[model samples]
Target: MATDQELELIHDPAYVNAVRLAGKGKLPKEKAGNFGIGTEDTPIFPGMHEASALLVGGTLQAVDYVMTGKSQHALNLGGGLHHGFRGKASGFCIYNDSSVAIKYLQEKYHARVLYVDTDAHHGDGVQWSFYDDPEVCTLSIHETGRYLFPGTGNINERGQGKGYGYSFNIPVDAFTEDDSWLESYTTAFTEIVEFFKPDVILTQNGADSHYFDPLTHLSATMRIYREIPRLAHKLAHQYCEGRWVAVGGGGYDIWRVVPRAWSMLWMEMSSNPTPTGPLSPEWLDTWQPDSPVTLPQSWDDPEGIYEPIPRRPEITEKNTLTVEKLLYPIRSNQSSSVKPT
Candidate 1:
């Protein structure tokens, strides 16, 4: 479990205490609104303090394994609660595990960290946590928060103070398909990793951008999920000497999307070949009855699973422009390196 001192790495002390009291019924529910508790998103449940701390603990343990050289890469599927703020919880997240882990990496190992977020919603809490810290560079690629929850993560929300240009956001348009989504992610990731050259990399892989997710509007397919980890794996080796920590986030379609997407991530981490063809009969039989939707038959989504999106050209063009803008600073630096004749 995460201790109060450890939690203070990112959360306020009073907010932490409030959660503890509220969990034990010492704090009144009516007063919990100020702390962002007892709401529809972050409901006040029994043992909430411990439950939240365990999520933090899972990510911290992943950090411990990587920092100690026990593992080159670590993953905690229960973590990546990036919407939790220093004093308040939102978006069903109580503690920002990635925020706390990034802070711990800086303090304990003195490592320069690169955080990549691919959740459908913006990672507002994590971005604001390290907004002015030069050592931590955060890159978030999400569906634009124009109408989404936590409404943030625009292209202009770079960094502040000494950390300017260190924080990058590329909010793609809704109805973004596999190719357009992957293009934004790959271009930004490649450029930023080369520019920052961080000592370690942490990725928040939220699978809610898929077409099946009920909460978000992005129309990404399983193809993007496969490529997401593939690029991260390759770059971690190239720049950070294989130091990578991955965590899960924002996958409400627990039956169909989350399992396959996350399984691919673990496969990439362990250097196993990506699976293809149909899923195991035993695996399907066990969960099929309880699943609300029909489980997929193969490792990849079938052809024509979603109808062709209308205005595809317009959406793709808009996303490409957003990526170019996000990478403008780096691109300009590259141009300056040309050295006039």
Candidate 2:
């Protein structure tokens, strides 16, 4: 677990104290409410501080492994609590591990960090944490928050001041399918990496965008998950010399989708072959009995996983517009022969 001092790298001291008190059930309900604890999203549970700190520590460990050349890439499935704020917890995240890890990277290694969040929700806290800092660039692609929680991540919500044009958000429409999602993701990621040339790439690989995920509205299948890691691994090697740290976020379907998506990520990172056809029967035999829903036998979701969306064309057009707008600033600079900072 991370030390309290380490958490202060991103979170406020006062907020840390409040969280500690609430975790031990010492803080009164009224007082905890001020810190955004005990609500439906961020409940005041025992050992909250320790649990949250452990999550942060896992990301820190990944950062250390990659930065120290002990590993080319590291994946922390417990990290990527991106909605946690400096002084407030939101969206069920008590601490923002990704923010703390990025700050740690900056302070310890003096590296330029590129944070890519692919969760179905906007990585609001991490974006805001480094919103005004040029050293850290955060790119998030998620379903539009107009009908989602946190209500942010608009295409025009670029960074401010010196950090302007660094924070990139591509909020696709609801019910967006695999092809459109990957198109936006691959295009933006390729362009941004070339523009920033970050020393290290930190990816928030949230699997909640799948159609089976209860928390999100996207219709993406397992194809995106397999392809997501492939691109990230390739780009990390190309731009950052293989320095990549991945963290998990907002995958609500822990049984079926999260396991498969996260396994594909690890497989890609470790240079193992992507499993196809049926999953290991041994693994299925162990987890299937406990799973509330039937687990898929194949590596990828079956064809026609969901009933066809009625507004597929409209959603695709709108998402394409958002991507174009998001890339306009970069494209404009290139066209005018102006270099990005």
Candidate 3:
């Protein structure tokens, strides 16, 4: 578990104390809102601090494995609480593990980090934490905040001062299908890594963008999940010399979408051939009894699982435009630096 001091690397000391008190049921009810506790999204429960800190510790451990050369890659499926703030918690995230781990990477390893967040919601806390620091670059591709919670991550909210142009946000429109989603993610991630040339790559792999997820409106399938890790794995080797750490983020469809998505992630990370047949009967039998919905029989989502979207073309066009605009400055800078002799 992470020590209190370690958590304070990204969280405020007073706010960390508040979470501890709230976890033990010692916090005053009136003061709970000051720290964003006792809310519907992040209600205080017994051992909340320990639970949150344990996730942070998991991400830190992943960082250690990669930076120390014990492993080329590490994953903490419980980490990636990106909505956590320095002084508050939002969107059911108590402690921001990605933020804390990035800080740890910089302080301990002195690594220039590139953070890529693919959760359906914006990675607001992690972005804001390093918004003014040029050494850390944050890129988030999420459902447009116009209809989502913590409505931020617009293209205009680039970094500030010396960090300007380092923060990239591609807020794709709602109901975006697999093709558009992958286009945005693939293009932005590839270009950003080339520009930043980071020492290490940290990815927040939230599986909530699938059509089955209740919280988000995107219509991505298992195809995107398969490819997301494939690109991250490739780029880790190509750019960061195989230094990659991945963490979980927002996936509300735990029964069907999350398991398959995360399993594919691990398979790709470990260099296993992608499985294409029915899921294991033993695995299905273990969890099917408690699931309210029928679990998927296959590893990939069935074709036409959802109704055909009428706005598919428009949505794709808009998403393409957004990515183009977000990358315009970087592309411009790259072009201008070329010698024409």
lDDT of 1 by residue, 137-247 (tens): 999999988878888999998899998889999899999999999999999999999999999999999999999999999898889888999999999999999999999
Tens-place lDDT per residue, model 3, 122-161, is 9999999999999999999999999998899999989999
lDDT tens string, model 2, 1-341? Answer: 98888899989898899999988989888888888889998899988999999999999999999999999999999998999999999999988999999999999999999999999999999999999999999999999998998889998889999999899999999999999999999999999998889999999998999999998899999999999999999999999999999999999999889999999999999999877889999999999999999999989999988999999999888888888889988888877886555
After the best TM-score superposition of candidate 3, give how far the Cα of residue 169 lies from its true spot, in angstroms: 0.3
* Every model: Cα RMSD to truth: 0.9, 1.8, 0.7
lDDT of 1 at 204: 98
Ranking by lDDT: 3, 2, 1
Candidate 1 vs candidate 2: which has greater TM-score?
1
Give the runs in model 1 whose Cα sits over 4 Å from its true position.
338-341
- Candidates in order have lDDT scores of 0.93, 0.93, 0.95
Off by over 4 Å in 2: 338-341
Clashing pairs in 2: none
Score every model by TM-score.
Answer: 0.98, 0.98, 0.99
Question: What is the Cα-based lDDT of residue 318 in candidate 2?
Answer: 86
